[model samples]
Structures are given as structure tokens and as C-alpha cells.
Target: MAGELAGHAGDAANHGIDLIPIVALLAAAAIAVPIFKRLGLGSVLGYLAAGLLLGPSGIALIADPSSVLAASELGVVLFLFIIGLEMEPSKLWALRKQIFGLGVIQVGLCGALLTGVGILLGFAPVVAFVFGMGFVLTSTAIVMQILGERGELNSPSGQKMVSVLLLEDLAIVPLLGVVALLAPHEEISLTTRLISVGVAVGAIVLLIFLGRRIMNPFFGILSRAKVREVMTAGALLVVLGAGLLFQLSGLSMAMGAFMAGVLLSTSTFRHQLEADVEPFRGLLLGLFFLAVGMSLDLGIVGENWQIIALSVVAYMLVKAVAIYVIARVLKSDHAEALERAVLMGQGGEFAFVLYTTAVTAGIIDGPTNAIFTATVIVSMVLTPFAIIAMQKLMPKRVQPLDGVELADGLNGSVLMIGFGRFGQIASQSLLGKGHKVSIIDNDVEMIQAAQPFGFKIYYGDGTRLDVLHAAGAGNADLVLVCVNKKGDATKIAQLLRHEFPLVKVMVRSYDRGHAIELREIGVDFELRETFESALQFGAHAIRVMGADEIEIEEMIEGVRVRDRARFEAQVLGGVTAGTGLLLSNAEDQARESGIAPTVKLVAAEEKEERAN
Candidate 1:
């Protein structure tokens, strides 16, 4: 009876729903992410540290990483789904030359180069294949992390990284299919494998078509029931259920997650669902990184440091050379070629999965497997260093001079830094009001995108004094730094203020605190995107509450003194609307009080005229 009871308990534990892992991940991230953020590192690295501390290898608070792994697969799916949504057909088509042509060349050349190196080191063809494919992928997390930190995520280099990543993402599936073939599964012919793939793909298409017709409506009704637990439960069910279907259907759970993301990517409620799923995704991905850390196998490292060291060296040198050669072939400058080469010449998250699968397939013996794992992990561990190295190595390329380009256009105009969403809006608003505006950006793609839409955008970084002059900043009446990054925005504001002392500066800040910093930097105007959205949302709510337009306007004015250029003490301080509201309210009150004075003066004048 006791044995039976133990069996039942074990079964329940294995299959029963538990949310502790999710909760713990959140708590850990909440504590660690902000601390790391304050330290000028990144939230992701902090989360990685948190995972290492909480995972089985550390305190073991998150003992079973299986659940986290399962959830992480979904995160990747959603992430890819969003990528697909962002990449419309036209954009993808335009990128065919890069995505397919250049992408194939890079992947093929790198794989062949890496494979030759791997085999020469005595790896079986299967192990070499996995190693080569895995090494070909750069760390998306690391590259994006660095880009985000420097506010360079939208730069020309950044966009190139995106295109490269997208191509790698597409390549990952076929690489897995190749690995499956190397495995010692029951004797399946080549035709059988191809047929299986065709069938699986067909089924996926059918399921997706069915899902688009049925999934949203089903979710809508479920949501309307207003049960918080049900919604969370349903989300988990979707992830697991879809993952199970994928596995049973002879594909990876990760692949299933990816397909699920693709379907949801086109959904009308993508943002809302994404927001809801984010916490789960983040925790799982964090734990996944932690798992990678735990899998480091310090014992193996100690015993085989020599082999690991050589592998790591060969890995970086070969990959870097490959990328460097490719960049040069593409006609990239010396600086750009080196930067891309350094940033990408390392293994990534997918390496772990590929290596493990290859080993399970008898393609690698025990010792070879250990070395392979170590090499990948070392590559990951070296990424932050690589980024730092790249930063140090990245030169100014060309020195900043008095005038880089001739002031071809009219020199006197409003310098509009950034040509993306916010900047474009600003330029139009100013232009519609008859103010001359000159737009600038560092992204060639964004410049091209904006130009076709009739935007007056030029390619250049706002921080560069040369770009500023080229944008007619010297003679501009005012300068608007509408770039989205706090650092970049602040940097531009400082540059303009220092170089063109007479150019009035206005900056677009991300938040209230950011706006304060901009104001401290003497920015003539600071507009926070969220503040405007919040104001609009609040105004809509007031209208819904039956507030008249005049009353609503007055109330909005009151709110404004809480945010805008107002010296009203009440708005700026304790238990009241901020400075913006008070200034607007005071103005409204003064107008109200002036009514009686005007009426009495008018009546006295009429009386005097009648008396005369």
C-alpha cells in the first residue's frame, strides 16, 4: 500500500500543474534585473546570474529546469512569430538577395570552413555537422543586448544583424532535419525522410489554417468569462498542448512553439497576448540560460582545459576570419567588417541543443562530446568580453571636422534628428506649420524607407557634429532631438548645446524622469511618448464619463500643469497634480476672475455715454 501511494504521489508530482517555478523566476528577476540595470550591465545578464543562483546547481530553488525549458520553447516561438509579423512579404522579398543569396553563401561557407576544422580535430561527420551548424549561429541575445545598451539597436549595423539572425532562424529547421537523419532511428530511407517532412509540413499548414479560423474566437469567449486563473491556465495549456502535438507529430516541441507563434503573429490581439505571455517567457528563458551555466561541468573544464582552450581559440579565430572575409567581399569598410566579425564569431544558444542531439545519436563519443560542450559554453561566456573588445576596437573611422559635407541645402532650418516614427511626426508637424525641417538618421534602410514616403531624411548619426552640420543644424532656428534612446537623445542634446550654443534644443524623452534629465540638460522642450498616450487615454475616459468638452479641456489643463512647463508650486509638489496642472488651472481661474472686471467696466462705460 505504501509503495502504491508513493507511486501515485510521484505520478502527481510529475504531471500535476505547478506554478512555483514561474513565481520564483519572477521574484528572482525582480530582485536581480534592476540591481544589474543600475550597475550599467544588462537585465539579461542579471537574469542569467539569477538563474545560476536559483537553479539546481546553486540554491536549487528551481530544481526541475524541465518546466522552464518547456516554457522557454514557447518564448522562442513567440519571439520568432513577432519577427515574422515585422517582416512583411514585400520586405522579405526585397531582402531575398541578402536573406537567401548572401545568407546561403555565408552559412554554406562558414559551415564548410568550420566542418573542415572540426574533422581535422578528429570529430565524426555527425558531430562535425552539428558543431559546424551550431558555430555558424551568433548569439542573438548577446548581440541584441549590446545593441540595446548602446542605443544602437536601430543603427545600420544593428539592422544587418537582424537580417543575418532572420536567415539563421530559417536555417535552424533544416539543420535539425539533417541531425535527425544522422540519428540511429529505425532504418528510414532518404525518400521516407523527405516524405515524412512533406507530410509534417502539410499537417502544419492544415492545423494553422484551422487555428486562424477557430483560435481567436475561442480565446475571446474564454477571456470574457473573466476568470484570471482560467486565462493563465489556458495559456499554459496552449503551450504544452501545442508542444506535445509537435513532438507526437515527429517534430520538435520548439518547432511547434515556433509555429504557434507564427499563427498568433497575425492575430489582431498580438500585443495583448504578447504582454500577457512575456512574464512566463522571460522566466523560462532566464532559467534556460541558467541551465546552460549549470551544464558548464566545471569538473570537465578542470580535467581538459588544454583541449577546451585550443577548441575555443580555433573556434573564434576561424569564425571571425570567415565573417571578416565575407564583410570585405560585401565592400564593408575596415571598421564595419571588423565590428561584425567580432560580434558574430561565437557559438549561440542553439549550439547546446544541437550538440546534445548529435551526441544522443552516437555521432559523438563521450570525450568528443565533452569538448564540444565546453567549446560552446566558453564561446557564450566569452561574449560579453567580445562585445567590450569590439567597443574598444571600434574607431571613430573618420575624425570629426568643422564641416564634413558642404552645406548643400539651405543652412538655416530646424535640425530634426532621427527620421523614424517620432521624428517623422515632428518633422511633419513643424513643416505643416511652415517651419523648415531637416531630418537625419544613421540607418540606411530607415533612410530609404522614409524617403519613399516623401520624408526628408538623410543618413547620419545625430551625435556626430559633422552629421549635424550636414543636416543644416548650424543655421537652424531650433534643434529637435527626437531619437528614442535616453543616452543617444541626451548625447545629441549635449552636442547641440555645446557646439551650436545658439541652437535651441528640444528632445523626445521616453519617460517623465527622462524628461527631467533632458530639462536639466537645458533642452528647450521635452516630450515623453508615454505621457502623451496617458493623457489621451485619460481624456477619452473623461469623455466617456459625460464630461463636456469645455470642462474636459479645463480638467486636462489642470492635468497639464502636473506635467508641462509650469511653475505652479501645487503642480510640482505634494499631494497635488504636478506643475503642469497647476499652471493650466491658474490660467483657467484667472480667466474666470477676469469676467466680472470686464463686465463692470463695460457697464460703467455705457452709463457714462448715456449721461453725456
Candidate 2:
């Protein structure tokens, strides 16, 4: 009886311990992500920190890193799937040249440079080549996550980066073949290579066919079933299934998922698939980062610190320089080239696979693999900081104004200082009324793009006094400072007031506080950029919620009056001074008022307006 009781207790304790890891992971992520984000370090670093804390190198909260890494890889697969969903076949076709041409050249150049560095570090030629090539494969997760967070994934530069990443993914197969060929003991015959290549090609064709033919019908059936969970399950099934197919064929799981996404990009179910997989993708991706953090073998790093540090610095510097030079040579601007270089400098998760394969094939030793792996991790850790440094240190590049007309001596009644969306809209009414409006902008690309659309915008930095005068700001009856940056707008407004005192300055305010600041500075007219639009939006929302049109209009007017009063109070005192003008839905406050809510609210607002 005593033995049985002890056994049961032990079983209960073991089960409870299993839950500890899950709790620790959640708590660490919850605590760390917000704190890091608040510090401007970003969520990726937070996850990594959490992993490091929990891993054997820290507190050993999670003893097994490999299991976590294996499981978390699904996050990468889902991430690729979502990326593919955004890339339509048309876009992929459009990017073919960049993907193949730029991608291949970048890889070849970076790989060669990195390999030379490895050889100088005392590795044999073949081992150095493996090391170099491994580092050339940039971390897709890190780059993509950063790009997504910054909302740059759809930009031209962002698309180019994505193209390079795609090429890297495809290169993994051939890279593996190279590894096989380089294996000293293993005899890889020409016939075997041909067979492997044929298999990979056939698998790709089969996947494309099945994705085109079967996936939509399969999703259609799942949707018709009318079960939300089942639809989600089906989406996961497709992602995982596609990933598994590629993994078996010795290609990247991410590539398979990407291919799956591209095929379904034109499907009606693409959005639904993306929505279903997003939550999983986020959670898993976080887990993946944590696993990578945990995988940093502190013991190996401590012993091989000097060599590891040297390798990381040398590899990253070489890779970065190569990337920057190649990008510049390929017609990328200095800023774009530098950004790409910094972002793609670090070795990626794929490096682990290459390193491990090399070990298995007698190409490198176990200790060397561990040191190299640690080097990659450290590089990954430094990437966010590197990006931050690059942004702070790098000056904004001014594009060549080859064919763009400079804002030279001109005369017009209205000198519009910016030609952004706001300025474009503001100029329409002035131009429609046959008013002479001179438009000037510093963005050469925007000017060129707008030229075909009949916008006669000239290139000029509105913040500069000379540029303003050259753009006819001195002679204009009214000067419109419609630039988006508050600092620029403020500078222009101040400059106009000090120099062109006779000219009326109408400025676009970024927000309510900005509007108040502009008013305090004594601009002739200042409008909060989104104020009218927000009011219209609120009214439309009330209308949609079944309010009478008259009631909606009354509410809108009331809001406007109250807003004006609040703004005046805030300007006189501070932002907190207008709290009394705000509406309250509390029953106690309503009872204290002793009048119908609507009447009392309007009366209070009107009274506030009058007092102001």
C-alpha cells in the first residue's frame, strides 16, 4: 500500500512538472516582449531573451532545446505560407529577373567573399566554402519579421529583399548537393546526382499540379461543411502537408509552403487561409526565436570565445561589404544597398543544417560546428541593434534629379510647398478656380511619377529659405506649407512669418496638439489634417448604427463645438484642462445633472463654447 501511494505521488509530480515549462514560456514572453518593445528593442529580441533565460545556459527552465527547435520550425513554414499568399503569380513572374539575376549574383559574390574569410581563419578550402555558403544564407525569419513590423514588405526595396530570400531558399537544394560532393568518404556518383536532381524537379512539378488542381476543391469542400474549426484545420493541413512534401524531397519546407501559397494566391480562399494561419504563425514564430536563443551553447562559446568572435565579425563584415557593393553595382541606391547589407549580413537557421550535414559527412569536427553555430546566433542577436545603428547613423540619400525641374524663379498667386496627397487635394480647388498655383516638392521620384499625370511639380526643399524664395514663396499672396513632417511645417511657417510677413501662411497640422502649436505661433490658418475626415467618419458611423440623419448632424455639430471649446481651453492652459468638456456615460453623473441626457449634454457643450 505504501509503495503504491509513493508511485502515484511520483506520477502526479511528473505530470505537474510538464506544465511548468509551458507556464514559464508564457510568463517570460508576456513579461519580456512588452518590456523590450517599450525599450524599442522589438519583440524578436524579447523572445530570444526569454529563451536564453529559460535554456540550460541560463536557469535551465527548459532542458531540451532540440525538441523546441524542431516543433517551432512549423512557425517558419506558416510564415512562408502567408508570404506566398501575398505574392500573386503575376507578381512572381514580374520579379523573375530580380530573383534569378540579382539573387544569384548576390549569393555567388557573398559566398565567395565569406569563404575566403574562412580560409584565412585556418579552415581547409572545402570546409571554408561550407562555412562561407552557410553564412551567405540570410535569416528569412528575422528579415521578414523586421520588414513586416516596419510595414516595408511591399516596398520596392522590400520586394527585392524578398526576391533574394526566395533565391536563397531554392539554393539550399543545390548547396546540399555540393555538400554531398565535398564529403571526403562518401562517393556521390554522377548518376546519383542526376537522380536526385530529377526527383527534386519532379516533386516540384507534382506539387504545382496538385496545388492547382486539388487545393481549391479541397478548400471548397471544407468551407461548404460550415465548420469554422474544420476550415482552420484544413488550412493547417495544407501548410503542413506541403511542408512535409518538400522536406521529404530534400528541399526546404518553407519553399514548399511558399509554393503552396503562390498557387492559392489567386484563389478566393487565400484571405481565409491567411487569417486562419496567422495566429499559429505568430505563436510558433515566437517559439522558434526562443528555441534559437536556447540553442546558444554557452559552454562551447565560453571555450571558443576568441575564435567565435573573430569568425562572426569577419563573416558579417565580409558578407555586408559584398552585399553593399553588389547592390550598388546593380543600380540600387546607397541607402537601399546599405540596408540590404545590414539586414542580410547574419547567418540564418539554415546554417545549422549545413553545419550538421558537414559534420555527418566528415567535412568539419563537432566542436567546430558548435562554435560556428554559436557565431551565427550571436550575429542574429546583433542584427536588431545593427539596424537601429544604421538608421541613426545613416543620412537620408538624396536621389539624382536628372530630368526634374528645379524650383527656379517663378510667379504665382499661391506657392504650394508640398505635393503630397494633402497638398494635391488642396491644390485641386485652387486650380479649378483658375488660381495660379506653383507646386514644389523635394521628392524627385514623386515629381517624375506625377509628371505623366499632368502635375507640374518642381523640385525644392520647402524648409530651406532659398528654396522657398526660388519657388516664388516670397511673391505669392498665400503660402501653403502642406509637408507631412511637423518640424518641417513648423520651420516653413516660422520662416514665412519672419521673412515673408506680408504673405498669408496656411499650414497643415499633424494633430490637435500640432494645430494648437501652429495657432500659438500665429499662422493665418491651421487645420488638423484629419479633423474634418474624422468628423465625417463619426457621423457616417452613427448613420450606419441607425441614427436619424438630423440626429447625426446635430451630434456632429455638437462634437465640433465641444471640440473647438476643448481646443481653446487646452491652448490656454494645457491638454488636461479640457477634461470637463468631454462626455461621460456614468449614471451617477447623469443623475447629478437632473436633466435629460441629450439636453444636458448639448447645454453643457454650448455653455462651454460660450465661456471659451
Candidate 3:
């Protein structure tokens, strides 16, 4: 009776103590999140910092890292699951060679080499295996976080990383399965395990075939309901149902979620679904990371600081160097390769879980486990510094095309170029607000489309100045270049700088590197045409039940804030600038500047609606 009472007391004590870490983590994260956002950094970085601060080895606020790591592992799982949900068979096949082949070779090569070093350092073979595999796994959390922040979550590199990360995440399941098969510690038969895997795969294939056939019709039925609430509920059912089905098949929940996502991807409403689920995904992901932060073990760190530090140094050096070499060999640009290396140099969250599991399973000893765990955590913490270091090491300068004009116009303060869908909207919006918008487009079709709209849309290459003069461009206040192509955007920006030196040019870019190129050429203001605002608004609207006007207004405000922030952050992070300077300078220049095109969108709509 006395022993039972003591056991109950011990359980309660541990539970109470566990809550301390959770509280501390949340407090720190709450403080850090907004501060980082104001500085234009991301929330993931903030969570990592919170982890470090709460870590027993650091501030000692949260001491039981084992428990923390175990819980935090779910964030990674859910992240991967969401990723799988995003991919379909056709898309999956397209990336198979890269994900399986390139990802396999990369992980294998990196792991083996790292393991060889561990062996030389006097660790056992099993220890080396654990260390090697753990180190080779890069952080999906960090990768996704960075992509989300930069609004490049759908870029080519982003897509490639998603494919690679998903394969790597899936590969973890097999690694454990294969290990268990090689050395059976459990009562389950090897044949049974094999059958389980086979069954999982077969079931997935069958569902995919059947789901594709039924999903369209299912969604069609919901659409006919003419009820948004019912449609949304039905959509959720499809996603959740498919996910649950995969889980029952002895596969990872993420794998199931991914298959469901893929099945849904075949639908015409794939983008809409992605749009629908994104808010839930983000909030869930944030909560997941918060949980991870709360799980850090402070006690372990205090006792093993030296070990953690050494392991972290070794892992970062090896992984970053290996990734840099691989990227260079793959023929990435010098700067791009360097950025890729630095960005992906950390040990992934999966490594932490794997290391802990292996240690518990007796596949690796305590010291080796410490080394792997500490290394991964430290590498993750150092990501921001690593990016800064890479930026310094591999600064890329954009060279404008030769013979591009430096200064040409004296009258036009703003030169609007490339008037297509984006351009027409821009011009109309600007005109609605009574801002003089000088329109230009290379496409004759665009000019023809604009002709009937009762706007004098000019037809010209925009590369030529005489044509620009005929359109009253010299008297314009600002240049809003909404061109689609990267090369053309660059050319026009450069040409304008040569010809219209006094006019402050606000240009649209393809992406970050493209903006960097424009910056190097000294474009006054550049905005990367990120698709995230739309995705972000859509996600928030569908999930949060945000009203239509509220959502539209949010998009407009978000667009302005995002554009303003991008402009300010880039310049501050470069040209030897600061955030205050960027903002003050931009505002001072645009103080007399009138309302933006987006500001007049409502009026334009009302006018057109009345006319119709």
C-alpha cells in the first residue's frame, strides 16, 4: 500500500515538473515571436531560440530534453504528412528520380562519410551508423520556415526541396523497418512486417486509383449543394477520411495525409483545397513547434555542455561542407550554391527523434546519442548566423545589360511597364484613384484588350524612349513595371536607370535572386511578385470564416505591408543600410506620392458594376 502511494506521487511530480518547461517555452516564444517579426525574420527562428534559451544546457528553463524531443517529433511528422497531402502520383512520379535517386545518393554518401569519421573518433560501428544517419538529415522545419517567410514556398527550389524532404521523411520509416528486420528484437515476424509494408503500398495504390475516380464526383456533389458550409465540411471529410484510411494500413499518418492530398491534387480545385487547408496547417504547425520548444530537457545540457558543443561543431562543419560541395558539383551558381549549402546545413528534426529512439533501443550508446542530439540541436540554432555568413561570403552583384540607359526621362516620375492582367489592373486601379499611370506593354494582344476598356494603352517595346515620350511618361511621378518575364524586367529597369535617372523606379521581379540582380543594377525599388498573399488570404478566409470584404481588404493591406517590408528589409540588409533608414527613406521619397493602385480597387469595381 505504501509503495503504490509513492508510485502515484512520483507520477504526479513528473507531470507537474513537465508543465514548467511548457510554460517557460511559451513565455519565451511569446516575447520573441513579435520582436523577430518586426525585424523581418521568421517565427521558426524564434521558436528555435526559445528552445535554446529553455534548454538545460543554455538557460536551464526546460530540463527534460528527452520528453521535449519526443513530443517535438510530432511537428516534423505532421509537417511531412501535410507535404504528402500536397503531392499526387503524377507529381510524385515527376520527382521520383530526384527525390529517390538524388536524395538517396546524397543522404547515403553524406551518412557513410560522417560515420567513417565517427569510427575514427573511437565510436562503435552502431554508434557511427546512428551518428552518420542523424547528421545527414536536414531540417524540414527550417527549410519550410525559410520558404514560407520568403514567399518562395512554390518556387522550383521549393518544389525540389519538398520532393527531397518527403522522400527523406518516408525513407525514415524504411530505415527503421530494415533495421528491425536485420535484427529482430520483437516478437513480430519479418514476413509480417514485409507484408505490412506491401499492404500499405498496395492499399495506397488502390485508393489512389479509386479516390481519383470518386473525388471529383464527391466534390461535384458538394458543389451542387450550393452551400459553402456543406462544401467545406465535405472537403474536410475527404481529406480526413483518406488520411485516416492510410493510418489504418500500418503506414505513417503523414504518408496517408500525403496520399489524400495527392488524390485531391488531381481535382480542378486542388489549388482551392490547398488554399482552404493552409491556415489550419500553419496554426497547427506553430502549435507543433511550440510543443517542441516545451519539450527541451535542461538537465541533460547542464551536465554535457562540452559534448553538445563539440558534436554541434563537427556536424555543422561536415554537413554544410558536404552540401556546398554537392551543390557546386550540381552546377548551381556560386552564390546560389553557397546559399543552399548554408541554408540546409543543419541536422533535421527527424534526426533528433531517430537518435533518441536508437539510444532507447540500445542501437547506440549514451555518449554517441548525446553527440548526435546535441549536434542537431546546435546546428538548427545556428541557422540564422549561417545564412548571414553565407550572404557575406557569396554576395552576388547584378550586372545590367550593356548599352542600357542610365538616365533618359525628366518629366515622368513614375513609368508603368508591361500592361497585361497585372498591368491592366494596376493601371485601372491607379486611374480610378486619379493617379496618372503611364501604361506600356510589348504584347499587341494586351494593347488590343486595353483599347476597348476606354484606356489609351500605349503599344511599344518599352525598350525604346521615343515611344515612352509619346505616352507622357516624362511627366509621370513613379514607374510601376509589372512585366512578367525576368530578362525583360531586368532590361527595362536597367534601361530606365540609364535614361530616367531622376525617376524612382518601382519594379516587379520574378523572385529573390532576380530582385537581387535588380538591386545590384541599382533599381530604386523592387517587389518580388510572390503568390503567397493570395494563398495566405485564401487560407485565412476559408479556415477562419473571414468575411468576404474582410478577406479582400486584408489582402490589400497585406500586399501593401508585404511590399513595404520586402523593400525595406532588402535595402536595410544591404547597401550598408538599416530598417529605420529603409523605411524613412522610402516614406520620405513617397511622402508626396499619391494613393497606390490597390487603394482605388473598390471604387473601380463600383464604377464598373454600375456601368454593367
Candidate 4:
């Protein structure tokens, strides 16, 4: 009876102890993330600092960093899955040249250079090769997160980096095989490596088959259930299951999750799955960074600071130079090549995996592994700062506008600013009616691209009064402001309204609020950018829902009339003056009864209120 009582007490104590780490982590993140973000250091560095503080090498709040790191790897797995969601098969095919061509060359070159550096530092060729190859696999999470923060993940340069990361993830399996072969143990045979490779290939094939055949149907059934939690659970199951299959096959779990995501990229549930996985991905990824921070041993660093410091500088310098040269040789411009080099200069999380495997295979002893790991961590810590410094120091390069005409003293009946999609479509009506239109845009690439398509777009900033005058805005009968940015469009509208009041202006409003603002500025005409398309979309939707075509026409007209009335009301009184003019299903039912009177009464009240 006494022993049973003791066991219960011990269990209670253990449960309580578990909550402490949870509280500490949450508290640390709440404090650290905001401060770091405010200071412009970013959230990753914040997590690392928090982890270092909570680690055994510091206050010892978390005893085992290895277990935390192991569990936190799920963050990386989910991160890859989300990345895969964005890469449709078509998009993947489009990036194949960059992935296979640019990626292969960068990794090959960097690996060779880094290995040479290791050998120069007195390491054996095999050991140096392992170290060099490990560093070649840059940190996908850090680079991706930074790219996302800067809104560059889909940019051409960012896409190239992403492609290289994918190739690196794929390289891990073969690298592991290489490590096995180089091990002192005679049992590590070529046959074992071949079996592992075969198993990995079979697993990938199985994942692809299941994803294409089963995922959509499975999601369809869960969606029908209409239980939100169940849909979220289903998403998690798919991610975790794919990861497990790859892990069992001795491949990267992240690669498996990525494969699953790509398979589902074309499915109807793609957006739903991405939304469900996002929250978990964020939390886990943060924890992963924290775990990495905790794993950094001050004892090891203090013992071998000089060697670790020298190695980090040498490795990063060699890797960065190689990447920059390779990128330049492949036709990337100077600025882009420099940015890529800085962003990918650091060794990644995979270095830990490689070094751990090396230790197990008797390739390197514990102390050497510790020193190498420490160097990688330091490099990771230094990367963000390096990028910030580069951004500050690097001079912005102006793109050469070769084969493109500048906005000179040309005159046309209609002056169109910005030759983007909207401006292009808007110009057609004027052109069809035989009005000469002069189009000006600041985008050199867009202007050059439009040239082959017979668009004589000249390089000019519409927001600049001098450029507008040069583009014949002063003499044109009709001035069309069609720039995409709200600020630029507004600035041009204001400029034309003040400088060339004789010319009638038609401006593209970004939204309803922008429409009101534009109207207030007294432009001759203004149209919300998406207003017509959205109305047409709604009309089509109603038609598809079995509404009579005549009734749909009436509804569309009613909406347009109501929108116009609301805009006038809003322009007269404020944005709040047009509430009663909004058309809803409920208003549709009451339209014949008292809706018109109510709208009139609301408009009158708004006028009176504004006057008062």
C-alpha cells in the first residue's frame, strides 16, 4: 500500500515537471520573439538565444537537447510539406533546369572547395570529404523563412535557392551511403548500400502511387463529414504517414512529405491542406531552431575556440566563394550571385545528422564531431547578420534598358501610364476607335517584353511630373492612370488633376475605398480594378445556380446601380454613409417592399449627420 502511494506521487511529480518546460518555452518565446523582431535580428535568432539560455550549458532548464532536437525535426518535415504544396508538377517541371543544372553544379563545386579547405587544415581526405559534403547542404528552414519574411520565396533568385535546397535534401541518402562505405566496420558493404537505395526508391514510388490514387478521395470523404477538426486530423495523418515511410526506408522524412505535397498540389483540397498544416509547421519550426540553439555546447566551444573559429571562417568563405562563382558562371547577375552566396553561406542542420552518423560509424571521434558541429552552429548564427550587412553595403544595380525607347517629347491623343495587364486591356478600346495612345511604364523588363508583342511602351515613371510632361500628358485629351500600386496611382492622379486640369482623367481605383478617394480628387472617371470582373463572376455564378438569365441581368444591373449610389453617398458623407445601399440576399427579398425608401432615408440621415 505504501509503495502504491509512492508510485502515484512520483507520477504526479513527473507530470508537473513536464509542464515546466512548456511554460518556460512559451514564456521565453513571448518575450524573445517580439524583442528580437523589434531589434531587426529576426525570430530565428530569438529562438536560438532562448534555447541557449534554457539549455544545460546555460541554466540547465532542459536536460537533454538531443531528444528535443529529435522531436523538433517534425517542424522541418512539415515545412518541406508546405513548400511541396506550392510546387505543382508543372511548376516543378519548369524549375527542373535550375534544380538539376544549377543545383548540381553549386553543390558539387562547394563540396569540392570545402573538402579542400578541410584537408588544408590537416584533416584526412575521407574525414574532410564528410565535413565538406555536410556543409554543402544549406539550412532550408532558415533560408526559406528569411525568404518568406522578405516576400521573395517566389522570386527568380529565391526559386533558384529553393531548387538547390531540394537537391541537397535528395543528396542525404547517397551521402549516408558514402559514410557507411568509409566506416571502419567491415560489415558495411556495398550490397547494404544498394539495398538501402532500392528501399528508398520503392518508398518514393509507393508514396507517389498512393498520393495520386488515394489522397483526393480520402480528403473528399473527410470534407463531406464537415467536421473541421477531422479535416485537420486527416491532413496531419497524411504528412506524418509520408514522413514515416521515408524514415523507414532510410531516406529524409522531409523529402517524403515534400513528395506527398507535390502529389496533392493539383487536388481540390490543396489549399485546405496547406491551411491546416501551417500553424503546426510554424510552431515546430520555431522549436527546431530552439533545439538547435540548446544543442550548442559552450564547453566544447571554449575548449576549441581557435580551431572552431578558424574552421568556420575558412569553410564559410570557401563555400560562399564557390557558390558565387558557380552562380555567375551560370549567367546569374552580379547582385543575385552575391545575394545567393550570402544567404547560403552557413552550414545547415544536416551537418549535425552527418556528424552524428560519422561518430557512430567510427569515422570521427566525439571531440572532432563536437568542434565541427560548434563551427556549423556559429556559422548559422552569423548568417542573418551577414545578410543584413550585405543588404546595407551592396549598391543597387540599375537594370540596363537596352532595346527599349525612353519617353521623349512624343505626343499622342491619349496618354496611358503603365502598360501592365490593366493598362493594356484599357488601351484596346482607345486603339480600336483609332485614337493614338502613348503608354509609359517604369518596368524596363515589362517594356522590353511588350515590345515583341507590338506594344511600344516607353520607360517613364508616371508619378514623376517631368516624366508625365515628357510622355505628352499635358497635351493629351485623355489621361489614363493605370499603375498597380495604390500610392503611385494616387500620386499620378493628384499630379494630373493639379498640373493638367484641361485633360480629362480616368483612373483605376484599387478598391472601393480607393474609388471614393479618387472621386474626391475630382477625376473625370474612376473604376474599381476588379469591380467589373467580380460582377460578371457573380452573374455567372447565379446563372449556374439555375437563376433565370433575365433575373440575373436585373440583379447585375441592380448591384451596379446600388454600388454607384453607395459610392456617391460615401463620397458626399464618408465610407460609413452607404450601409443601407449594400445588396444582400435578405435585401433582395425586400427590394420591392421598402428597400428604396430605407436607402433614401439612410442617405438623408448621413448628409444631416455630416452637416451637423
CA RMSD for every model?
A: 14.3, 16.5, 17.5, 13.6
Arrange candidates by TM-score, descending. Answer: 4, 2, 3, 1
Segments of candidate 3 deviating more than 4 angstroms: 1-30, 51-92, 182-190, 220-250, 365-371, 403-612
For model 4, how does the per-residue alpha-carbon lDDT over 405-487 read when each residue is reduced to its tens digit? 77889799999998889998999899999999999898998998898888898887777666787899888999999999885
Clashes of 1: 12
What TM-score would you give candidate 3 relative to the actual structure? 0.61
Model 2, 300-374: lDDT tens per residue? 889999999999999999999989999999999889999999999999988988889899888999888888889
TM-score between candidate 4 and the true structure:
0.70
For candidate 2, give the lDDT of residue 2. 34
Where is the poorest 10-residue window by lDDT in model 4?
Answer: 596-605
Better of 3 and 4 by lDDT: 4
**Model 4, 228: alpha-carbon shift in Å?**
0.9
Each candidate: how many clashes? 12, 0, 36, 0
Please list all clashing residue pairs in model 2, or write none if there are none.
none
Each candidate's TM vs. the true structure?
0.61, 0.67, 0.61, 0.70
Superposing every Cα of model 4 onto the true structure, what RMSD results? 13.6
Name the better of 1 and 4 by TM-score: 4
lDDT of 3 by residue, 321-361 (tens): 77667767766666655666677778777776567668666
Relative to the unseen true structure, what is the C-alpha lDDT of residue 105 in candidate 2, on a scale of 0 to 100? 97
Identify the runs in model 1 with alpha carbons over 4 angstroms from their true place. 1-39, 50-73, 144-156, 183-186, 215-247, 252-266, 397-612
